[model samples]
Target: MSTGFIILALITIAGAIGAMNCGRLVHCALSLVASFAGLAGIYLQLNVWFVGVAQILVYVGAVAILIVVALLVTRNAESDRQNEGSKGWIAGGSVALLVFILLAGALSNTAVTGAATLAPDSSVETIGRRMMTLYVIPLEALALLLTAALLGAVVIALGGPKPGRASK
Candidate 1:
């Protein structure tokens, strides 16, 4: 409703689109960082300062950098291959349309049904406690997934030998 929210929404949408449609992996990662920052701005506008800070720190700082680094380490730097696989555009457009329709429906049907709200004393400590106690398993799974991705990238970048010449 506020100007800040409107600006942040625009930034988020533009950055997300740029990230999705970028030809270069590094550019996509940078656009992701922009999108994360925009989301953080929205969190701040909603008065969740801790969430905003954590979003910026975790997403823009660590995850985005890690994505760029992984792409650089595993992919050929000189290659300019765009994502032009068969049915790529159709799949992407279908997903986008589905997301738009779902979001529109959800927003139209949303109601303010909450009775209890967070107290003024609520801090990052409460969030941390809840995450550690109730969300620990999912957090651990995400960490494990990231670890596996890192290991896979390392293997792809450093473990392979060059293919031999084919015999005629």
Candidate 2:
């Protein structure tokens, strides 16, 4: 691997570890942005420009921002919540071990069928045209769905209007 790729991979791993271990929601969200940015850099280095930009825009820009906003909005609600200890660690570890074993077995059985090949033309223009002509509706629907989901999460976290409670 190139030195640049190695650097970006290290950054990605560091960011992911920071995000996973962080106790504060804001810190975790920022760490996720760092991870996404490194991933975007890797994608750009691979010449998949569309995916790279989408990674930055969608994950770093939108998702991270939404997470921070949610953290702020629910900060008070979460203050009173008790941390659940590693109650499910045994079950979680078992599931993770099973998944790892399954993946390892499957990968061990797979064989390389062909040499690696790069696409001749994977430019932004071609991707834009395809997105506009073929995948516009699905893409728009996805955007709407994500927005709805974010709003729902925020509302639920804020404990929006208890059932049968009269609103002012």
lDDT of 2 by residue, 120-142 (tens): 47787887898889999998999
Question: What would the TM-score be for candidate 1 when compared with the true structure?
Answer: 0.68
Residue range 10-73, candidate 1, lDDT tens digits:
9998999999888887788888888999999998877788988989999989988888877877
When summed lDDT is taken over every stretch of 10 residues in candidate 1, the lowest stretch is 159-168
TM-score of each: 0.68, 0.72
Model 2: what TM-score?
Answer: 0.72
Q: State residue 30's C-alpha deviation in candidate 2, in Å.
A: 1.5
Clashing residue pairs found in predicted model 1: none
Which parts of model 2 have CA positions greater than 4 angstroms off? 77-84, 134-168
Q: Give candidate 1's whole-model lDDT.
A: 0.85
Question: Local distance difference test, per candidate?
Answer: 0.85, 0.85
Error of 2 at 103 (Å): 1.7
